[model samples]
Target: MSRPDILLYTANTMNGWKPLIFLHEAEIDYELVPVDLGRKEQKAPAYLKLNPNGRIPTIVDRGNGDFAVFESGAILWYLAEKYDRFLSHDPKERSETLQWLMLQMGGIGPMMGQAMFFQRIAKPNGDEVPYAINRYVAESRRLLEVLDTRLAGRDWLVGDAMSIADIATYPWARSYFWATVSVDGLPHLQRWFDRLDAMPRVQAALQLPEPRPSVFGEGDITAAAQENAARFKDQ
Candidate 1:
């Protein structure tokens, strides 16, 4: 079979990492097109044609008539279905996997992203936004606790195997510091996080756009955040 030429347009954010995690795990051949969020490259006219939302982590399946997919979770689902891996063939297991994936999409990612914005970005702006900060932090923590409970007797989010559910959630949950929500007391979540972190594929995916770090340095982070704030102001 001829391998598809998949181009992933992404940055160094949680959502960006999710699809890469699945790609690496599935051993699918793909290319990385780094979108400079700090420079607002994602909002460019050409890029907007690929992802109308003007977001990173869009995938262009060039082998399939340049078919483009946007949104992190949706990208993972597409790849999983394409490769017949990560997601299960069993209907019950597949339903469970999708449910957990949605939890990350609707609850974990948004709440944690807001927490990071308020604590790391907005706080430094001197605006602080205490109400927003507290609300998201508390909510993120609550979500972490829920994950911990769900993971207590299980090794993976759904069934006995790792699936898109784990891939969808790990990136956000791993950055506990950024979200200002700790999983320290959630032993089960900690175990799950550590187990996934030890995987070589996960390590590789986390280091996308290598040799040039995706994470901002402390020295210029304030400026970086300010720039990002303007770019995502519509949110």
Candidate 2:
């Protein structure tokens, strides 16, 4: 097989899956270069040059003079602009799409990540902090409520179609159960989640690199948390 023009440096985490899902939806040919977080490969000197933040989901666009892009949100924007798909050209609709994308970047992602850290990782490691857990979990739920409200009477986050906003947020939001947050009362959000969750592209994206174990299954949740803790231990 011929080499793809894009090389995605990623893991199986929620953030890592963002661009992967987009790539599938856009039907772009790409290569997946899995970064081994457990081995601290993301912090290696070479990887640092690509992503100074030392994070997953970085991309090297071979078709664009080998340009490198880091941060999940920025990567999504770059791909959307380059491919001229999944992002609208209409002024108002484009702005609305960006607004919802920013919500995921600045709000949902961080809040839910913190909630998962406190409830799953920290707690499992015997570093349980009740205040921290309560704070993040509550904030996560509030963000979900905001999404729930926005999703009411609508199928997508922006305009009348699925855009980068939905692509970026779905991975994080669908993992709500693992974060100890509930989506029980948010019917609209639940509907949206089910809609995206049932898509073949979304399902296929989750299996790339490898299939991640479900937290609800017999998987070792504590071990998973411990692995994640190592990523932020020095931060």
Candidate 3:
């Protein structure tokens, strides 16, 4: 079979990582094209045609005649179905797997990402900082706890194997590039996270150049981002 040319216009965010991790796990052949986020390149007119949402991780499936797939969770599932692996053979198990994926897409990802942004972006004055941080941190912790409970007796989310669900949720498991997760309290989640981390495919997918040290800008916004970066470090 002729391999599809996979054109991935993406940054190294969790959403982008999801698809690449899935591709590597499937051992599929494809091309990877980096979209320069540093230049606001995703907002260009050419990329707008591919994804009007102006997001990274937009994948073009060349084998499918250059059909495009947007949204990270959807793309992960598509890769699994296309590569014919890391998915359930039974219909019921497949449905459950998708359910978990949606939970991550709709719940964990959003809540955790908000926690990330608040921790690293929001200019909190007075009590806003602690309140916002506590709110989001508690919510994220609760969600992780739920996942831990659900994983009580299973090695994976669905069936007896890993699936697109794990790919969907792994990014948020360690947000902001291993920012502040303990991986200590949640034993089950830690185990699962380590299991995925140990995979050669996952490691290959994560094989990318570290972001170069650079200054963002020369003014106020730049200073704010730097401040957040500092506070993020303190956390």
Candidate 4:
């Protein structure tokens, strides 16, 4: 199937931003194909063919045999290996990068995602599940502390340079407050966040496919979310 040079199917969500950061940082040419989560577009048959899991942030690399890659972490890994960027060359450094990437992929990403769902999205829907909220928030905060400690004397997650681990982890960390987790006491994490926030590449990645509004905001998205929530509740 012919497609754009690099077609990214994604929503304006955290998981969606992960590979985007890498795409911009690596200077890979791509076209953004926004997926409307509010309308359940991801579950459509055509999209499901690209990603059996029916998730956003899937990439179809037309330059590489119309190859479709799904799952944010796997997408990042594929891009890094294909473009020969982010993932380190040294064995020890490469291992460190992959380990920290997995920390975001397996640990913080899932925990904080649930935290956001319960604390921010689900609550206003009259589905305030406190146990779920508290459990995820506490765990998400704990993960932030872990990142804080890991970044105490370092600038990046793995080696000296910013790798896929940092890219994979940044979107979730940037949305820490959405999880009701405070980073005030985590000075190192704050410093790292600020440092990355200042990067030109990171900034550009956050605002891909011009004309879309900023996804990161502390403002009210409840009404819009509720509309989408109603659809999800029926399932």
Candidate 5:
């Protein structure tokens, strides 16, 4: 195979999967360089030069003057614009697509991440703070309801076809179970999710760099979470 022009530095987390889905859907040639979050590889000086925030899902576009882009949402926007795929050029549709994409970046991603941090990570470490857990989980559920409302009677979040908005949000929304957020009464969101879940590209993207571990699976996730938490605490 030809050398990939895009180098994706990522983990198996929800945010990390956004670019993977987009790249797969767009059929772009990219290399996956898995960042070992547990090992604090993201915090190392070399990686920090690429992503000052020391986060996963940073992409170095070697084909584009060796440009590096951080933040998952930004990466999606950059790739979509560069490849001229999964994004609309029409004024209204493009704005709508970006609005929903921002919702994922500002709403679903943060709320769900906090929910997961508190529900799965904090609670297991004997730091079971009920207020934080309930606060984030409820907000995450409410965000899902917002998406459900947007998806009502519509197949995609924006325009008639799936765009970066859908790709960015799906990874987080699908992890509601891990975050302890429910989709109990959200039919539209559920339907949209099932549709994306059934897509060949989405399924293919989730497996790159290996499958992510389930919260319900066998492993010492608590210790893992604690290690990660300690890293962030020092940061």
Candidate 6:
């Protein structure tokens, strides 16, 4: 069987960008089929056939001409399994790395999402939006502490080098500027992020598309996220 001809259908979503960031990091060759979420392209019947949720970041594995993968986390896991790199073969290390990957998928994604929701989308009527900010910011800080502990001595998520764990996190953790106002407290994680940023592969991935104007101050994604969420909820 030949290596599959692949089309990664994705928008510029954090989730969508996960696989692209990984593919670029791992130096995998594949075609990018930009799926415009703004045009309602993801909800199109043809696209829905690939992902029932009609989400971007779906991949068609043309080698079989039948297999397609959805879910950003699943896609990165699949790519690592297929490419046989960016992940460890050892059982313990592999499991550890996978744990971090899931942590980012489950922990960071939702917490930060709520941050975007209440802070930017809902048009909060207060100076602080204390409830929303405290909730997300606290959880985000907790998760970062977990990551920092894991990196207490190691340089990477896995035992030896950068792995799928890092790749999966590339889109979100790398957006630290958006997730939090300061990582100075997370010295280890901050260092880890800096190290990942310096890699040639990661550097190449960054060149693909700049992310959200750098997460410097608090963002205003709440309005957009709320609108999207309301639309999805209504549907």
Candidate 6 lDDT (Cα, whole model)?
A: 0.71
User: Candidate 1's residue-wise lDDT over 101-218, tens digit each?
Assistant: 9999999999999898876666665667889988998999999999999999999999988999999999888877667676678999999988997999887988886422323233
Candidate 6: which pairs clash? 120-222, 120-223, 121-222, 121-223, 177-215, 178-215
Q: Which stretches in model 2 have alpha-carbon errors above 4 Å?
A: 215-235
TM-scores of all candidate predictions against the true structure: 0.89, 0.93, 0.82, 0.90, 0.91, 0.82
- Superposing all C-alpha atoms, what RMSD in Å does each candidate have to the true structure? 3.2, 2.1, 5.9, 2.6, 2.7, 4.2
User: Order of candidates by lDDT, top first?
Assistant: 2, 5, 1, 4, 3, 6
| Span of 10 residues, lowest total lDDT, candidate 1 | 210-219
Q: Model 2 TM-score?
A: 0.93
Model 3 poorest ten-residue lDDT run = 209-218
Question: 1 or 3, which is superior by lDDT?
Answer: 1
| Each candidate's clash count | 0, 0, 0, 0, 0, 6
Q: Write the per-residue lDDT of candidate 5 for residues 164-184, one digit (tens) a residue.
A: 999999999988877878899
Task: Tell me the tens digit of each residue's lDDT in model 6 across 42-77.
Answer: 899999999999887899888666689998888888
Q: Write the per-residue lDDT of candidate 3 for residues 1-235, one digit (tens) a residue.
A: 6666777766666677788788787777777777766567788999999998988788898878899998998787777787787778799998999999999999888777777666555534222466776777777778888788877777887888888888888767655232233445777887887788689878677653223212112236545556556544422
Q: Residue-wise lDDT of candidate 4 within 135-216, one digit each (tens)?
A: 9989999999999999999999998899999999998998776566888799999999899989998888777543223235
lDDT of each: 0.84, 0.88, 0.72, 0.83, 0.87, 0.71
List ranges where model 4 is wrong by over 4 Å: 1-4, 209-235
Most accurate candidate by TM-score: 2
**Residue ranges of candidate 3 with Cα displaced over 4 Å:** 1-3, 123-129, 176-184, 209-235
